[model samples]
Target: MDIKKGYIFPKPFWSSLIDVNIRGLQEECYEIRNNVPSKYKSNLGQNSYHSPNLLNLQNPPEILKLMKQITNCIQTIHQQSRRENVRLVDFWININGKGGSNVPHTHPGAKYSGVFYIKVPKEMKRGNLFFLRDYNETYLTSQENMGFFKQGYNLLPYDLPKIPVKPLEKLLIVFPSWSPHSVELNDTDEERISLSFNYILFR
Candidate 1:
């Protein structure tokens, strides 16, 4: 199957298992947040540095099990692609509260990146996942060659497309790593819990 650019893959086959473990981890992380003292919490902007205050799971036995399931899903896609191999470099969770958001940025040095939404409240007004349009080369070419009769060139200011927050229970979104993306701030009082991860494909 030829996956189109910016195509959001259907929910992976093993997502049910992933959802179960993610729910368990989310509950545990929530409890930890409530008990632990956090000196600073995220505000509405790009993350400057990863917080030690937040739980960072790299190779926990439970998380590893979850990662394996995710890896299997990614591998299934990789096999269909021209490339036949892939690797999961790392995975981590982000706990965003009201007003916390990430600025537009692309994953550095990875082939594919994605996020699995765990919790989304009903009151959030503006929080959504956004993907930047791939336009850098096209922009430069258009600027150099002023074409009056270009076939498909519709010149306009570019804006990233936003994926609205549906009932984000078990939604897993994957996109190219070079695709710049961001998360909008949660305007309401509730928190948004999500897991962001990346993988490197060996061609």
Candidate 2:
């Protein structure tokens, strides 16, 4: 049996855990939680500190340096010829505790969005990120027509309706702004801290 795989409109993204000062980033999160005045409560998460604009804010030198590196990494992943033109537009910090989770949402105006995981509980239940696949393909390949293909390994791997992504400390995940994604409930008592950011190209 010979089978050829071809991608029609495959969604592509990038993720990695780079070497950084995890402990220092964790400390910075705590400081933001304690000192930041703005608290974003619209979402279902436990608590979120929304910065006005990370690029405009007078953040610590260390934090700004890391953001620059993240932008470079994302540019490399996308294979853009003008690497210096890519920039991170904004970013915010999120702290999800027990029973907290984010609803499905997409970035509004940015070309790309990403999250950097600083702190994750040792025992995480449902706090992982899950990307929702486009419904057109799944709806067309319903049980009525694709029932027989589900028997064994007959169906291709790209037919799934959702994709779950695990989180790790020092990890960075970058994807298109239009991708719909949500977080599961934080079952563990400890807090899940992450820095979410958006990026755009100037040239």
Number of colliding residue pairs in model 2: 0
Query: Tens digit of lDDT per residue, candidate 2, span 1-203?
Result: 89996778878778887788888878877776677665563347545444444567667655766787798788886566444456787888778777777777888888789888888999996788888765675566666656745356654547666688898998899989989888888888898887888888776
Q: What lDDT would each prediction earn against the true structure?
A: 0.60, 0.76
Best by TM-score: 2
User: What TM-scores do the predictions have?
Assistant: 0.64, 0.85
Clash pairs, model 1 backbone = none
What are the RMSDs of all candidates, in order? Answer: 7.6, 2.8
lDDT of 1 at 192: 76
Tens-place lDDT per residue, model 1, 34-152, is 55443333335332222342224333444455567667777876676456688877665666766678777888898777777767777776778765444563454453554454578
Residue pairs in clash, model 2: none
